[model samples]
Target: MRGLVWDGSELALVDDLLHRPPGPGEVVVEIATAGLCHSDLNPIDGKITQEVPVVLGHEAVGRIVERGPGVRLPIGTRVVLSVFRPCGACEHCRAGRRTACRRTAEPAATPFSRDGLPVQQFVRTGAFAERTVVSQSQAIPIPEELPDAEAAMLGCATVTAFGAVEERARVRRGETVLVVGAGGIGLNVVLAARAAGAGRIIVCDRNPRKHDIAVACGATDFFVTPEASDVAKACLDTVPDGADAAFECVGRADLLNATIASLGWGGRAVIVGLPSADTELSLRIRSLFHDKALLGCRMGSVDPRTALPELARRALAGEFSLTPLVTRVAPPSEAGDLIADLRRGELERGFFDLRGV
Candidate 1:
């Protein structure tokens, strides 16, 4: 099968790979569609370093083509896989904080491909491959009615934002929220906050093209960073006491700082973006003493089995839409160029179509 491979030197399409069947507690997914996310670009460009010869897609939807021992789901079930890995026996998992599972950082215990070399899974999902193996807990069943392209996104973007707002931040109804960066994750954050009944949702990004898109995605107002004079002041003017919560989705240290500054007294700032290793962020203690909080949210703190289906139901109900964010679609061969474009701020929020293969 043809899949994108990162072998330390560069990322390229490799067809000379071999996939093995699932082992105990694992299931094999024949990927139907995979979205090219900004996170995938991080390791490719050395922004985030990983073991070489790794398959690099973390967000995707697939069909259960094969199952190993101890797995309950039937074959041919359509599913969306979660990037978060939970060890059922871990203290965190036992306490129901699977999002913060104590064993997540341990080396991946499953395998995807083997030949003269073994391939590592990026984020433990590696959905870029034609068929990948994951633990049963990673698979989330989806309704047959949902399109693969749309369902593919719910696995990552939707569930992550939903977890960030609902589980991590605990954003309350009538609270004001400001989401910085209107990319895949940021756009979802805007929508989730709205779904949670946020009173005023303000979105900030450097891209002016996203203004209409943000408002349509539930942003009450949109602000472009560079030209928006006194962004924090402007946001406070809208909420008087400032936004009750702010989310930084771009993963840049500077934007993280700015988002924290935009929060009101007793406000919470959630960092959902994955920043580069060299990136550094800081805040003043005096300001934090005013009851402000800085939080780190991972994959929206949601169980894919639950949140993915709920997000799909909401999209089907016309309450939230992911269509507006898809700015382009291309095959896996074009991935290198797509990553280059995304790095230059040329690609907008959206999915890249790789199903033609």
Candidate 2:
């Protein structure tokens, strides 16, 4: 089988990789499409920790090729795989926390091999390969009508963006919302806020190319970060008392601090982006005095079982367009350059079209 493997040195295609069959309570998935995300570049760039020589895809949709003992799902079921590997029985999962499931963390043992040497599974679910074996719990069955490329994004971008706005920020109808960054995740935040009937949707980004979709996705106002006094006046003149909720999707401290300041007295600022492990964020000490709050949202603060279905239903209803957000659909062999473009903020979302392989 072929897969995108990273050896802690560089990321590229590995031609001679192998996939083990599913064990009990597991399923082997034939991945049809996988979305490339900024987070995927973190390990290769040493921004995040990942075991070397591991298969690195985490957001994808596939068909169930086989199932292990006690697995009830029939073969050929189309599914969206969740990046969060919740064990269902762990304390966190038991409490319905999607952050981490104790036993879901990749163990020292992995089912992959490259030229006879053991390789790790990047996030316990390595969907970069032609096929991946994962616990049955990770697969969420969706209507077969959903497109593969778009379904692949539901596992990451949509969940992170929509979920963060709807859940973390708890945005209410008639309220004002501000989103920083207009990339994949950022755009989704705009869409979700619109769906919630936000009165004003403010988006800030340095890229004007995103303005079209930012508006299409429900951005009522857009700004070019560097020049426009638009962002500064947004909290001062636009909403008067500031936006009801602000989402920081850029993962930078400076912007996050600014988002915090751009909130109203009782506004909530949700951290939807992942920053460095050691990055520190600060704001005026008095910002929190007026009932203002800053929150950390992990995996959009959603339960995959429920959130994925809701997102899928909304997509099927034509609430939003997915393919329009995609910039490219290419074979997995081009993973290197495409993924680097994502790291450099050059692409919104690109998918590895692996169905033909």
- Per-candidate Cα RMSD to the true structure, in Å, reads 2.2, 2.0
Looking at candidate 1, the ten consecutive residues that score lowest on lDDT are 348-357
lDDT against the true structure, per candidate, is 0.81, 0.83
Residue 329 accuracy (lDDT) in model 2: 82
Cα lDDT of model 1 by residue, 249-350, tens digit: 988777777777788888999989988878877767776777888988778876566678888888888787777666666677788777777666655554
Q: On residues 1-357, what C-alpha lDDT tens digit does candidate 2 reach at each position?
A: 888888888777877888777888889999999988777777877887777888988899999999999898899999899866676776888787756565655463577887788888877788889988888888998888788888998988998888788888889999999999888899888888988899999999878877888898889888888633446565556777898999988888888887887888899999988877888976678977889989988788888878888899998998877767788888988887787777666777888987766
Candidate 1 clash figure, as a count: 2
Candidate 1 TM-score, true structure as reference: 0.92
Report lDDT (Cα) of residue 7, candidate 1: 85
Among residues 3 or more apart in sequence or in different chains, the pairs in candidate 1 whose N, CA or C atoms overlap within 3 Å are 163-300, 164-300
Candidate 2 Cα errors over 4 Å, as ranges = 91-108, 227-230
Scored by TM-score, the top model is 2
Model 2 lowest lDDT segment of ten? 227-236
For this target, which candidate reaches the highest lDDT against the unseen true structure?
2
